[model samples]
Target chain A: MNEKLDITLTVNGRSHALGVEPRRNLADALRDDLGLTGTHVGCEHGVCGACTVLMDGRPVRSCLTFACQAEGAAIETVEGLADGDRLHPLQQKFWELHGLQCGFCTPGMLMLAAGALRENPDMDDEEIREVMSSNLCRCTGYQNILRAVRAAADVMRAEGAQG
Target chain B: MKPASFSYHKPGSVSAALALLAQFGEEGKIIAGGQSLVPSMNFRLARPETLIDINHIAEIQGVSDQGDHLEIGAVTRHATFHHPVSPCPLGRMLTKVVANIAHYPIRQRGTFGGSLSHADPASEWCLVAVTMGAEMEIHGPAGARRVPAAQFFRGTFTTAVGRDELLARIRLPKLPEGWGTGFYEFSRRKGDFALAMALAALKVEGGTIRAARLGLGAVGAHPQRLEALEAELTGQPATPQTFAAIGARAQTMVTPSGDIHGSAEYRRELAATVIARALTRAAEDAA
Candidate 1:
């Protein structure tokens, strides 16, 4: 009943060409079509940022964006944060700071914080909290999550200065 | 929830998009940022037969300076206002207002035109458009025409732009030199729907108000300019006492309905409070 269109989406440095229905959102395609299930769907609306991913280095709600509309766009999901064995600084900080309780909103939080940290490496605690406010976390009460983002930002800034 | 089945058409140019809109008429819906429309589609509230994706039309993207006025393309992202594509007076006002939107991620995708065309009374863009006296550039079968922001918004989720016409761009005139402006909104949470909002701009000279533009949002079916209050402010002394009196008088000037957010009486009270704060801040900025 739905028309299918061809699209090529580059996610986490890997390009995948697939066909999706016109109504298929980018979040569903990233999870169902590609097997990268890190991107979660909470509200399925733009209000909640659970399905957020980096598009061209900027955070965007994948649930609201159509997969076909994302053709030729560079996307980054939670799965892209870690290497084979070494975890990204954000993941390490989250683990150390106890940023996750149920871990449902972690993927989206990590992706958004990654984008935020990249844009503002010297971001303060208030800035980190402000950016993470969109993604809802029922478990952590957001205190630890803010700490994790702040710690990760410091590490990222130091690494950037060195390299 | 997933949106219903629909045919998607991605047009490369404005003419091609207009052609499809004319062909489909009411059966088609243009998708720009998709931040608002996609969610509505998922809820089955808005189900158009044809989804015309206009993300690739480069002609209606980015900012252009028109000497006296700055023309902002409809597809320009809200995040672009944070550090504007180009610096202008409008950016200073937009940065304050855009932060009140959903979040950083949503701001990255939501477009200036999409929000204006949506015409949500609570939207920051709609309120500011009315405050700035923006002119909307529309394109259709008959070619192009400009509609003032005052006339562009007809009602809640309604605009003067026809189904066959597209809101291509919006032109915001540069505020007079030394003009000070303020935008304030009250939402339950940081990104929630606003209950009451106000935008104020003041151009004061020799301790007297030369021009005062004030607008209110989320207090009615559409955002409206406070013409009576604005007239009262003009030629008046730029003093906090005068602004406070005008703000208190503004409560009686609006007609707002009660909803889940707050009571009608409560919103009226807030209208006075926000308007007063906005006016005082704008006056301070002018000095």
Candidate 2:
């Protein structure tokens, strides 16, 4: 048997230091060990974005990454998008647009879209679709998801100008 | 499924990493970003006993402009190449193709060297490196040696990197003025694996073709340069008709295998379409 490894990670502004096996993935660590189950695990093979999370502010498939690989890295899961029960603009837009159906892919979709909006605040519909195409949501045909991103972009821009 | 058990080491320096590789021999696998290797391990496709993680090795980190060539570190993330502050048009082209790879999440963890070392023929970085005449530097106990892209890739998921060697950096020659470039790929869906892809770089001088480099992917064991079509285009008049004629000639140069997404005949037709579209885009970029 292999020895347990020491890992330190910061998720949603909190630090965690734990002993993990060498084979444990970041998604498993988030859901099983850390009890941050907002980041789902659909296809452990990376084909599904249900395991997406933000590593140092950039979206990455947590299922395909080893927990030790993220040591000293800052992470953000779906649970980090809220501020004391107040939802993010993207979360509100997703709720208003009915962007989710079965809700299995929502956590990953929200994280991916939030990262895209941060990188490009003025992305159009076609651009949003092209960027979000990497994240697969079987229930929603993706039309409403595209609309939600567009609507959220306006809300984020307005909030930015006001501040 | 969980990955097989393995020992992990993250060395802080390149020399220490190379020393670790030399000590571990065939039991070691160097991991850059773990975008490809981690999934393979999880699926039990690859079972290396020891993983030499090189992500913390600072020597192989960023892009450097060296006047005649751009020296890109092996560990440079795909996101860095896509940023607006990148120096070359090739960086912008890479950014566009990288965005279409898997998704933003995968790109954030995928390193330039990881893609090259993975050696997937359908991968964007492999095709672009072969087309642009990039050079790879490998370090071992004997020190560093440079291998040209033309001689680097051995076959599907295979490279010339030896067991004791580590890919250090990739050097890409800067594009000369008046050079046009294009990259086109046809896939069943956007962000899916490519069925067929083509890359073209042409240097047109005063309406005449001074030089041309054409590369085709997903049609062979390794991405290949179309030397026959390149020879035919040199010194010829640059025109839409000439490009179409060359595209037809290029169709015969490669024989792609039949797969689930596309038939062999369909892929042949797509080769022509991709090449023609790439040439037109390249010409427009040059103009």
Candidate 3:
């Protein structure tokens, strides 16, 4: 409730103008101000990647980014992944492969994977596990998560080659 | 937890940012990527009255190859070193060290100048800077000055960058031809802070070590160059015996304090092992 700074950010292809405190982080602004809520904050520090989001096509820790710093940048959250009724291929693979049990880390994991796949769709199992290890998960033991990302990568690569 | 209230200033130019730094002095902190500073602020560890965001300063934001050296802008992201958008001769060594720095998301936002200014003892960039003899270009009200990496880091979490100055660029010298480098790290986790690490770059000619540069991290208050080891390796055959002896000598060079991560004794032993392994790798690469 101190002095609030005005910022305009493009989130999920939609522009939002809001007044935010300089101290407010990006994860809080997205969840509280915009009501997106998909980006969860577990550690609130850079160690845990639960608040991961794509910033201008690169995955960044939203909890570590101030809302004021995100002005004029394009951000993509987990809510922006699905295409209306149809789930993203990564989301479908996660559901089919049981990638989540508690589902707390699923949103951040999806955002990280989406960004990673977008950059390189031909990631192998080791690369997938190595890249996904940033987002810590206590629930599903990570085997299913690894399998899900692999499956999604295969599908995404085939889809990319097709179109 | 959230950070306390503070004013944010996004300067459009490097001079404007420096002016803000001079105006605020110790009360101001520069934010390049905010990966480390924001987390510390959220934990209530750092509460600067004003945050000078230098991310918008376009002048200090990319890599420039200067023929003999690579000039990396202050705001150059860690991910850029891994998959360099521009030409970089230090690509091999950078790829190995970048992966060992935190994780993918952190690399996406963390910057070279931020890491250098933060000056964590276990930071891979600090070790790399010392091993490569890089220079830090700093700008302030007094104008610009370049400090060699050896004199840049003062102590744990401290550097030569004045409170009213900003790190503008890092100048990393080109490795000489016939040189090979190795970065060996032993962190508890893949992307966690290293418990102990070794950086080695060697030039072997006619099966003899011509020149060697060695650095150790997480075994002391700051990453330090092992000048004695470097001198001892000169003129000797690049062999396992020499590396073993170098490892033993390196164990006596550091003074590490016992902490939650590990004991001083454990770190010394770990440092020796990593040094030996790094030397072997560097020799193989040179061959």
Candidate 4:
């Protein structure tokens, strides 16, 4: 039997030590070993952002990143977006705007959008399109997705102002 | 599709990485970010027996500004160059282009050295690296060597890199005070590979052109530096007429090949237009 390599990773503020092959992708490792399937796999070629996850606060395609490459790295999958049962603002906007149809691309889109919003909370429509262009959703024509991002931005801003 | 089985080694130091390269030779491949290599491996386009992962090598990551030149580690992420606070406008522009490359997720995992080593003629980073006259520092079993941008790239998907060598850092000389730069590319979509691209850098003195450097990509086997056009611009007055003449000279400098997105003649014409536009913008910036 091929010896499994030891890997230590921090996911969603929790640390885990696992044994796996060096060739295992972060997306596969998250879904199969850790049982966090929120990070979807689409196009596998980095063209599609279905497997997007936050690595040290930056969104990266988990499908293209080797698990060995992510050793000792801090990762946040879609499962970490919400605080317990309380939904993230982006998730609320996604739900309110019907930003998804099949929901396969939702988790990735939500993560990317959340990252973008955190970086630029006041992002306008064109800016949202420019940033969201990376993620592809064949089910949605991208109009509602754009609306969801804008709606979420507004919610984030309103919450900030209220506080 | 899963990547073919391969042994992986994580070297902690640059010297250790080079030693691994020497031990494995052509049977090994270096993985940084793994944006391009992983996909290629899964497709069976390239399958090596050993994979030397260099992400943990501390000496081969980050950016260093040494007064006269900027030393960029090979493993520096593309996002580092794109940050808004970048000292060099050229560096900032590269970051913006890289941000739009594929998508944010890909850029997060892609390294500047990986992109340059990939040497895709259509890649914007390769064209910019050539235009800026960047020098690549390489370490191998034979010791360390530096190759100037002009000689670094050999051909499409090829460079001066050897099997037992790893690119360690990229050295870019600080631009002269009057130097102005511009980069432009036309793609099918926002994040698609460039159909045609142009980059121009020029130094102007009192309305006269002191020096000029121009480069074009995706139109040839390798990115071409417009020496002929640059020669015509030197010592001439920096004006619309001078730019027009340089554009005319650029038309004959490259013979773009036809591709799925555009025809040969169309790319040639687009090259001329982009060159003119880039030169004009760069000249304005210098002024």
Candidate 5:
């Protein structure tokens, strides 16, 4: 049943050509094949949102998306969130605001938020909570996740205003 | 869970996709957005030998003004409706109703046409299409044919779309001037499917309801329009009492089957409550 296709995945500003089966979802392709383990797989069937990632600048459930379907699309995961040793505003705020206690859902939450805030940079705290509710967080009760995303949005907005 | 192995075919255009569908027929399943189909595939509920991925088909994407109606391409994702796609009241309805269609990520990839084709009883888009009297334009080897929403949706997880045909685009009638829309749903969780949902569009003039459209979803096998109630609304005074009266009647109109979410009687109550809420919102805009 495994008919492998040689596909090029453009992820995190890098391209990786790998021969993967048609059954390989984007989450498994990233974690097992490409060694980008930041994406967590939970509920594997699109719920839980632990495998959320950006496909062409929009957040989508990587667990529900086949790897071959993602060819030529730009993918963003938690691995691409930071700039070198300097943490991204979102990552920094998550740290300062205590966004994670379990850390398993962190990568998915960060990527989901990063994609959401990019789409609507001026989202207020209430709007942030609405969008951030896409991913489930069992720890910290989601108040801190909402706080982190809101704070990061402010920083991003200020930086955006300067330029 | 992983999906079963299948031969993948990415068609660059609608014609190519149709050709693939015609060739594979029942064996080839069209994959657009893959929000619902892939998950069912993951559970092994659907195991197609050939998967025709329509993501690459650029011709069937985006929403466009088709003069009398808005033509939404089959591959138009739910996220596309987050903003008003038109200046008409229909645009407002789309934006208001889209947020309830699962979470942000699922909406980003879930296509409107795919939702209609999937025909999930709880789908927001399905309710919208049925309420709006939308027309579906399907493409097949024979030619293109149009199916109205009333006839398009057959049952739960079923539709009029043929095995060799593709729903290329959806045509939603541009609502008349002075119409206001309302949508309300009761879901247990933020992104879960609704237990009961209602949508209404009302046009009020001179304190009288001129035209109205009403629909209920998730409480039954398929989304249903309260056509008799819609007729009853015309010439009636635009008042909350009148809306509540119709809402009360609507509760008995739909035969909502029971599920794990709620009992049949519970859904009947929910249906009535949601109808009242939706009608109230529509009237707020009409006011």
Candidate 6:
């Protein structure tokens, strides 16, 4: 018998009150309990970074973070990135620049870049490459991922400046 | 894979956390960032019955400058240092070193005090702490005790912290105005554990090396200061030849074991090269 924690996670501007066991990871809670399967889990260990998500505006591995640990945290998954049907700037750039082949690592890459660019909107190509190196992508060879993130960063900056 | 079932306690204060840690003894663990611990737990390597999560303890969550030193709280996130924490040159050095620790997201969650407590030989924080002469403040059932970083690390993944004790804070001495610090590391990938790394702090005055501190990591079981090289550097000119000469002696000082990543002889060679590079950078950057 394990203890179940009654916790509330604010995901994608929606509040989800979940009673989860202490051992249940945040990725599982988001996918199974909340029915948000966009957050993929490639490696339960924190290596692949496939389950990356934004907790309080900082990117973190959902697989390593326990659901209980994320209590009261503002969780932002891939499902939260789009404004209705229209794609976010990062997603648009990834699609136009051919950032993915298998799409297994696309969600994590997008979230990681979103979090990083939000904090630093004026990153150069080298800096974008360095940040993109955090996640693994077997199919697209990473060049396209870096190009997509850098291009999206420019677009996001332009949109913010216009606003 | 998930962590084995355990009772999780989120303590608001250091004393409360220490109390729970004391009560659980060997069956307990303090989960900081869980960047390293959670991975091991998922692999079924660590099965603690009780988890003391100190993330909510605001008391142990930031760094404070104490004129000559910095008192970094135990749970202070590594992201806090992304921007310089102190005006001292040590802050710049720490920023440079922190960049090499894993990747972006891991740094956002990891902590300086957690890295010191983990005491991985390849850990850049451990190398910096041991090099800078950091003092660790630990709380336990008996009270609190301060342990120097030199004596704090026992071996790979082992430290001076006892079963009932918890690392509360780390006090690192700030480098003076004229000193320059340098760090160099080699790893297989962008965010892997360093195979060989060197950290050097140098103070040059009037074309002569007045002070020097050198530390090497991941070449052996524990990170340690190169006192012999430090002594050799002092009183010598700040030149590439001098640094290279001292670097060659690093292979003789350390007895590293061979692993799949590198042979013992290869690590010894890497140690010398990185040490030389770090020293050269330090000399070039020193004001």
Candidate with top lDDT is 5
Question: Considering DockQ, which of the candidate structures 3 and 4 is the better prediction for this target?
Answer: 3
Q: Model 3 clash pairs? A: none
Error of 5 at B77 (Å): 0.7
DockQ metric for all predictions: 0.83, 0.78, 0.78, 0.65, 0.84, 0.82
Q: Per-residue CA lDDT of candidate 6, range B1-287, in tens?
A: 77789888898898999889878888889999988888999989998888889888888889999999999998898888888898788888888888899999998888887888888889998998888899999998898999999899999999999888889999999989989888999998888999999999999998699999999999988898998889999999998899889889988998999999999999999999999999988888795
lDDT, model 3: 0.90
What's each prediction's clash count? Answer: 0, 0, 0, 1, 0, 0
Worst 10 residues of 1 chain A by lDDT: A118-127
Model 2 Cα RMSD, 1 decimal:
1.5
Task: Give the residue spans of candidate 2 off by over 4 A.
Answer: B84-87
lDDT at B63 for candidate 4?
Answer: 84
lDDT of 2 by residue, A1-163 (tens): 3898988889999999988987889999999999999999988988789888988888889998889889888899999998879998888999999999998999999999888788788888878887788788999898888898889899999999999
Q: Put down candidate 4 lDDT per residue, A1-163, tens digits, no spaces.
A: 2457898989999998888887788999999989999899988768789988888888888878888778878899889989899998889888989999999999999989887777678888887998899899999899999999898889889999999
lDDT of 2 at B104: 68
Best by DockQ: 5
Q: Compared with the true structure, what per-residue lDDT tens digits does model 5 show for residues A1-163? A: 5779999999999999999999899999999999999999999888889999999999999999999989989999999989999899999999999999989999989998899888989888778888888888888899988889889999999989998
lDDT by residue (B1-287, candidate 1, tens digit) is 88889999999999999999989888999999988999999998999999998899999999887878888899998888876443555667777788887788988889999999998889989998888889999999999998999999899999999979999999988776788888888888888888998999998999999999999998998888898889999999998789789878998998888987788999999998889888888888788
What lDDT tens digits, residue by residue, belong to model 6 across residues A3-117? Answer: 6889998998899888998888999999999999999998888888899999999999999999999987899999999999999999999999999998999999999999998
Which consecutive 10 residues in model 5 chain B have the weakest lDDT in total? B251-260
**Alpha carbon deviation, residue B160, candidate 4 (Å):** 0.6
Cα error, candidate 2, residue A34 (Å)? 0.9
Compute the lDDT of residue A42 as modeled in candidate 2.
88
Give a tens-digit lDDT track for model 4, residues B1-287: 77877888999998998888888888989999888888888777878778999888888898887777778899988777556424665555455456545566677778889888988888777887887789999887778999999999999899999888889999877676668877777887988888778888889999998988888887887888878778888999988888877777777878878877888999888888778887887888889
Off by over 4 Å in 3: B84-89
lDDT of 5 by residue, B1-287 (tens): 78778999999998999888878888999999999999999999999999999987888899999888999999999999999999899988999999899989999999999999999999999999999999999998889999999999898899999888999999999887789899999999888999999999999998898999999999888999899999999999988899888989998788888878899999999998999899989988877
RMSD of 1: 1.4
TM-score against native, each model: 0.97, 0.96, 0.98, 0.94, 0.98, 0.98
For candidate 2, write residues B45-83 as lDDT tens digits.
Answer: 999999999999889998988877788899998877666
Which residue pairs clash in candidate 1? none
Report the Cα RMSD per candidate. Answer: 1.4, 1.5, 1.3, 2.0, 1.1, 1.0
Better of 2 and 5 by lDDT: 5
